[model samples]
Target: MEETEAATEKAKDLIRMGVARAALLEPQDKVEVDVVPSALIIGGGIAGMTGALNLANRGFEVTLVEKEEELGGLLRYLHRIYPTQEEASDLVKAKARKIRENGNIEVLTSAIVTQVQGFFGNYDVTVKREGKDIPFKVGVIIVATGAEEFKPVGLYGYNGVNIVTQLELEVMLKAESFTRNNVVMIQCVGARDDNRNYCSRVCCMTALNNALILKERNPKAQIFVLYRDMQTYGTLFEDIYRKAREEGIVFINYSPQRLPTLDKGFVNVFDEFLGEEISLLYDLIVLSTPMIPHPDSGELAKMLKVPIDEYGFFLEAHVKLRPLDFATDGVYLCGSAHWPSTVSESIVQAYGAASRASIPMSKRRVIAEPIASVVDEEKCIGCGLCEMICPFKAIRVEEKPGGRIASTIIASCKGCGVCGAACPQQAITMRHFKDEQLLAEVMALAEGT
Candidate 1:
């Protein structure tokens, strides 16, 4: 009886504190902003073209920009695709044709985004083309700027002639002039090392596909693949891997500590299974290098005010919840810009990004959540700390007639409470999570209410 009475008194005290705190708290207001109803896609690769077609087909205008003179990015250079063994050029051409025929889609070649301003559902983008600036408004932007193959120039004594990269090997295969009977392929050339530390994802399959092609070309050709690990993960890829082995292609696993040494006409490696060093004469050596982020990725990330990982790939908002979106609401990402991906994977991601971006434009308005950062002009000292600390650049210090003051772009604020925590003068507060409201909840829990 005594313990119950004490608990009741504690609960009563917490209820009183909660009531007082609730009285001081105020509800936040919601803002509705108009959307532009258009999108900007920054790439003309398979991913970008697919995204553009999807958006245009759905009745949304799309501006597809490419840095190169034509569309088809890296797919244009490939001779054939894996698993099904389809002609890569035909696939790229079909997609390009669809994008070109779509009236709602505007294709811009040899163009680059010079500037980006405004916020979600209302962005002002400027593109540079032929010594001119083309400015336009867009509801959202998708970055599909694909990656480039890592040039393994000096590593493993790569000479680009006999010792060529997988991409270069594709060119030789396309020309049908690769008449090397004794061929050797080295995997993970500049990847999974101390410098890169990534798998490259597609190198193993590419090497296997090319190896099978060579075997088909020359029945008695001796082809050897030296790999760290075979990543034939999917069902189709696994089937091809088995087929390569059945066709008498030799696969040898090597350790990073015992990498293959390349010479003019011979390659030496320590075979892990055989537990012995082996030297084989080769007419051609192909290095399966990784795909790295483009050189312009940094500049583009800065211009869009989005985050990129340490390796320079664009960082998405969340790994699961918002895989196609950036922390900035108006921006989306797909293809190798996010990571090294195959053509099919890039197309899937592009479609996902396009669908995600179309939501606001289709709605034609943005209803901002009530929870956001609010500024207290009286306590603000214009220190600019909040402005600098904001990842989304949601806060800015403006010069008024009286003095300088910090202001929040309500639409741009993600309600992350970053500015509130960074403010030294206690001038910023996050609505719906203010001090009084949080304290009331805390006291309520403490009293077991």
Candidate 2:
């Protein structure tokens, strides 16, 4: 009888504890906010236009802004595209035509985003056009500001005459002014070096493609390509590479230690395969450099409150899961703004960004997830520790009548819980994962319930 009483008392205690713990769990209500079905796409380049057209096709209004007076960024300067040898002008013209025809898209040229405020689902944007600041309310933003080509000026003794960049050479090719019988192209001129340790992904292919073009123009032109490594990974580019080899173009493997030296229409280099230093006389020396981030990328990133990589390219939310998105919700990235990309890759990324931006617009309302950070006013000491630790800048210390307190912007809080973990007074708590709720789970596990 005594044993039975003791066991029953223990059972009662466990039940009481479980009930008390269960009572501490407070269910949070979902916040529903009206969403604006409009998007702001920065940059009127190929990616920007493609993303705008795609969103407009989905019945969403779009605002496309360009820093330049016209559309077609780098594409406007290119003579022809690689592998297919298609005229870049034709492609840009078609995309521009579609953008102009799209009634839902409002194109803004010679405009810059002066200010950006608000959060996901609703953003207040200010554009400076002709010294006037125009306001725009948008649901999402896509950053497609393209990058600029690196100009290898002093490197390799580039003088814009004998040693010219690939872009300059493209212009000469278009004008039919490059009638040089002997030409030497140097790949990875301003890239894959100590300063820039990234391979210009397309420089090798560009050299080969342009070499083939030169061969087509003059069958007897002596063309040579000096490269560290050929990055013709794609099958189409590889096919072109093979065709270039078959067309009697010489490809020499060169090392950085023995980079080609230029002296008045002559280039000297040590060929790795031949194991000998050789000098060649050429009329033109084309330096195939990489595409770098735009000079204004930092300023743009600051305005958008987005993070950029060390190389000044906008950092995506995730490498695989959210390549088109920023960590901040409602903001997306595409094109060379993210990284140096080819035309096809830029177009694909633009469409992906458009699709992602259309999600909240399709739902017609933005639903806040219940998992968010909550503040306990009584325990808060107004130390501002939580505010300082928050990476999203979601928490702010406000001065109230009684004392200062840390307040959380629930819509901006991503439930990362860094603020809660960093709170000295333990005043900040993450919803659905409060201390009492977590302790209850621990107690349950301990009792083997």
Candidate 3:
């Protein structure tokens, strides 16, 4: 389709910028870019990288900015991705190679977007990279920051003793052989209860993977995975479930209705299935907790004007049709930054998201919205209320020759016209509404005057 071809061309453009950025970076700067990006992909994780690469393929110049010291996100910590159990690092390395080959994508590690303004088709993003701030004029934005695991320290006594998280287990699996002959894994330690109701999709699967590995390591090992439900949907995954049972792995039905207790050397869980209470002894306890969004998600959502679900995941406009795209036309969301997903799922989403970003490049460039806020120079009072109230931090509050003041930076303004609403002196008039034009509408809506 025409859309697909256009996407490819822009993808190439962004990749060229990537090489340029790498060469010009300063000593502390992990990466640098001078290009006015066609789209900005934030988070640099699986979703971010996939979005960047796919957008590059579509011929969009993409700037991938990550807050972490390196990329790969959660995939870096995993020993192997499940179902396939493929080497996680090898997969990440391969993606890194493709990212290098793509000439249209530029990467910035250890970078944080401090200020973002503009809307849909045109936005100004200010980022801090290596202690220096940089700004970019972008046509689109994609958020793929991903999620972090929760520490159920109290529930499972996971104080780094025998109690550990799925990630910690991965590390221990590689470091030293666990002495526990009987390992009991508890699922949903911090998810899908009254607090977090959404199923994390991958926790059950991850627990299964770990249990199977533990059993494989020691044929005499007793691996028990306790869960409310075992959701092994999709083709071939059912086979994985069957294999786990064949390997002598035991699964017990647990309840989120009551809190699970951990004693000195055993787990005291009610036998909801057997209609009684029971205690299971184990040397190690793995808490397969659900992933939670970063605590700053609320602030980030407000700053970017992005919508988030009540539970904290970035809420996408349409679950299927828009996949990575937000309800807002030019914004996109990806990975655990939005919701939980496996590396394979995240990578697929990354591709879908980045591919969607090629729209701006099809036109070669974008035009600024004319509906931005405007100051009436003569009537304007330099109180500087608009500058500070802007969530995007786009306003430039400046003093004039006298005590009088004025403001500028229209491109950074989203044309939301919240400033005009906030202005007390009524000196600011947003485009499309003049003084008389506003009065007529207000009067029409108002009760008879």
Candidate 4:
């Protein structure tokens, strides 16, 4: 009888506490958003062009902006694509031709975006062309700026004449001017080291592709490839590696501790597989360097209110779930701007970005969660501290008739309570997390205890 009485009393107390907590809660407000149906694509590379075409075909207007005068990006410098041996120029021409025929895509060559204003789904951008600012509005923005090859300067005595980078070797191969029978190609030139700890992802395949090309050009060519680790992943790349070996191209494994050295007219490297140092005379030396992000990517990331990684590559919202989209809605990224991806990988990401951008445009409306920060305008000093502290760029202080006050873009706010904590005048607070409501719970609990 005593145990039953205690249990019943405990249940009653729990019910009372639940009721008290419910009484302290307040209703949530709705945030209505209307999405625009246009897109702005930066970088007129293969990825940018592919994304523009996909969106255009889906009946959306696209503005394709290119910093250069032409459409093809790094592809223009390549001789042939890997695994398929497709002419790089032919592929570029086909995509550029399709873009030209598409009426929905507005190509802006020799133009650069100088300024970007407004929020997601409604952006007012200013493009600079020939000292003139061209202003336009768009719903979505895609970043497809490609990467640049790292120049292996001072490493292994690299000179443009004899010891050249992979990119330079492509030019010689395309022009059929590479007549060197004794060739030595060094992999991981500027990557996979303490300076750059990430793999270029396409260097191994590039080496294999070029090595096979040289073999095909001259049957008597003797090529030696020195690599830290061969990254020939996937079936197609693996087949290419096998063919290189079948064609009698010798591959030597080297360690970073004992990198290949240039001594006199010969290259000396400690072969890890053979467990011995070997020296070889080379008529031409090819250094396989990694692809690096552009220097001005930071400026563009700031303009779009997006984030970049330590290596200057644009960061996605999530590595697996949201690989092509940014945390900022209506903005997406693809191609080498994100990482060192091959042509096919870049195209796949471009298509994925286009698909993600289409979702908001197709819906035409977005309803954000009501759990956002609320601003007490009367207490606000417009100090602009909240704007500076906000990681999502959700809050902004504007000038009103009386004075400056902070306003929250409820759609963009993640309700992280950062603005509330940083507010000097106690002007910022979350909708569901008010001071009085929190104090009510604490008081109720204290009384029960």
Candidate 5:
């Protein structure tokens, strides 16, 4: 800790030789408590809000950070929600109001976490808001930074005026002035395709909801929903599928192997159910697509020392049993960033995440199992191989003034010994998962020294 403060001061000296040493640290190292704190909840979306509310209710001083100016995320943009047809803004506003009123919840809107430098019980969090750096130490972290809406700009010329995504369609519907008579909606544009092959899980229900709205407004309007498969596989959704069909909304089936074609005024698509190619004149086309992860996920994963799956979903510690937890002891994940889920599903996930967060609140302090690694910085070459190999981003190279670079950050280190396997100089080793633990057994088996 002394060396960390010294190195930080020295680096600042380079930029301002005359600035006093007192000004170097920038009030940047905030300890949530004078001692290390128990937890941090990232994002202010549904999952994050739920996690914070739960953890705080259980007696933890929780910090909830949101990158957006507002806390509700996608839910805020929605006017009315499905099945119940309840006003979406009303629900989000209630949560936002609850969070603000809760004394235990520390809300940070338009804030970003620049650094998450510690592990389970001793994480050093650096948050930036309005040019001020606030630092805090916490025992746990909850990653509920939900997903961004997918954009189909290139594949089908979605950038045009009439062409819009499901999110934009929501805005139009909320505006209550859409006079679209021949509205055509296309499905599976950016999802379940060759490049991105996972079903988004909620597009069908969304299309069904909007179709009902169109039917209620302009009775003569022709609303068309074209899709390869309608995956309404959950409770209440199947009922919605029937209601859409009953309301005179036309559903067309198409082979995903082929692409939908559009011209200046006419749209051409192969109607698979009808076993024929057909053309239709339409005023507007809405693309019902699934949510995608934000572009900054890789950077956030690195800062938090977490792993993202091949499909770009953040990999939790366990799939079913620990559905909302990361591989680390004090970190958790939930919502669209994990995968496609409905508004209700997101709310439920937020609630579960909050319940999980309550565990840390019940405890006064956190204790990490002592299987994690430590580094011998004296011999570290700082080549950045072990840095890359540790999927958790636990290894970081820090330059010390008037000395060679050093590698540290014990709090972010997981117990995995893979970093030792990548070291040419053998400078890094997990405390309990030491190389000698395996080496001695191997030597005895080989009958060699």
Candidate 6:
């Protein structure tokens, strides 16, 4: 009888604790957003065309805008791709043909995005085309604006004649006009320096590829490659590097502190292995320069409200988790626009970006978290503190009839409680995280009731 009485008392205490904990709960409503099933692609390069075709093939509308008059961005200036030695023009032509045949894709050449407004799921973009404005709305935006080869204008005596960039070498190779038999390829020009301290990532492999090509053209050519480091990453590229060495191509390592000097048709470089300085005679000098961000990337970044890296390349949301996405939803990045990537890498990233964009368009609706912030207009002073402090731009203060008031953009809010902490008036309350509700739970736990 005493044991039964003790059990009944314990059950009553448990029930009382459950009731007290339940009082901490607050109701919340989820935010549902309608999605627009269309995409706006900037830059009609291989990456942009590949992404556009992927979406259009899936029965979604795609508007491809290219600043140039025709398609094939950087690929248009190339002779052949490495590893395969296939003509770069053929790759561009095939992708362009696929884009043309896809009925769902609307290609706009010689166009520039003049204005961008609205938020995710609905973006109003104005394209300037031939002295006219064309406005359209898209569900998502893809930036594939690509990069440019850095011009070593004032470095290495680059005159675009005897001395030229790797890109210029490709042009000469394409035209069959490179008649020079004694060539000196200098790697990392205008890259990995105090001014621009980043590897172009493709320079070393490009040097190897071009050196091998020169060897193929003239079996008797004496080619010397001077580099800081040979960044041949993959086995295939490493094999190419080995093949270049086998073909009697010479590679000399040089230090940045003691750089090679151009003196009267000879490159005087100190060979680290030999511990001696050697003068190599050259009929042509190829400066393997880095790829740099386009000049207009800043304007486009501001228009899209996306972030760029220190080097002006597009920054992804998270490098590991969300590599192809921006912090802002409905936007994606790919290709050399993010960094200097090869043809194969760019194509792979293009497909990944297209897949990420398909999620929202396929769903047709996005559900926002219920635990968003709420503003009490009665207590809000509208000092714009929340607006200024918000990292995600989820809150805004606007003029009302009586005074200014703060509002929360539910879809964009991550419910971080930052606004609540910064608000001076205590007008902002993060739903489900109110002070009283939290205190009640604390009190109940402390009291053990």
lDDT of each: 0.90, 0.87, 0.76, 0.90, 0.76, 0.90
Q: In candidate 4, which residue pairs clash?
A: none
Put down candidate 5 lDDT per residue, 141-220, tens digits, no spaces.
Answer: 88888887788878666875788887887878887777688988898888987778888888888888888887788888
Candidate 2 per-residue C-alpha lDDT over 1-449 given as tens digits, one digit per residue, 9 for 90 to 100: 37997787778767766676778877689888777999999999999999999999999999999999989998898888875678988988999999889899999999999998777887899999999999989988999999989987678878998788887877778866556789999899889888888986877877787788788889999999988999998788889888989999998889988788876667898999999988888988899999999989999887776899888989998998989989888899999999988888899999999999999889978877678898999999999988776766577789998699989876667899999888888888899788988787567656754
Per-residue lDDT tens digits of candidate 4, residues 269-313? Answer: 999989999999999999999999988999999888899998899
- Give candidate 5 regions above 4 Å deviation: 1-38, 372-389, 392-414, 427-449
- Residue 135 in candidate 3 has what lDDT? 87
Least accurate 10 contiguous residues by lDDT in model 1 = 440-449
Q: What RMSD value applies to candidate 6?
A: 5.4
Would you estimate the TM-scores of all the predictions?
Answer: 0.91, 0.88, 0.77, 0.94, 0.82, 0.89
Better of 4 and 5 by lDDT: 4
Instruction: Score candidate 3 by TM-score against the native.
Output: 0.77
State the TM-score for model 1.
Answer: 0.91
- lDDT (0-100) at residue 76 of candidate 3? 81
Candidate 5 at 355: error in angstroms? 2.2
Per-residue lDDT tens digits of candidate 1, residues 1-449? 37998888887877777786777777667899899989999999999999999999999999999999999999998988976689999998899888878899999999999998778887889999999999999999999999999998788778888889999889888977666799999999989988999898999999999999999989899999999999999888999999999999999989999889965568999999999989989988899999999999999998888999889999999999999999998899999999999888998999999999999998999987678899999989888999888888677899977689999887788889989998899899898788877887777666654
Which residue runs does candidate 3 get wrong by more than 4 Å? 1-37, 101-103, 117-126, 134-138, 175-180, 194-197, 235-239, 309-312, 317-323, 327-329, 367-375, 384-418, 428-449
| Index of the highest-TM-score prediction | 4
Query: Which candidate would rank higher by TM-score, 2 or 6?
Result: 6
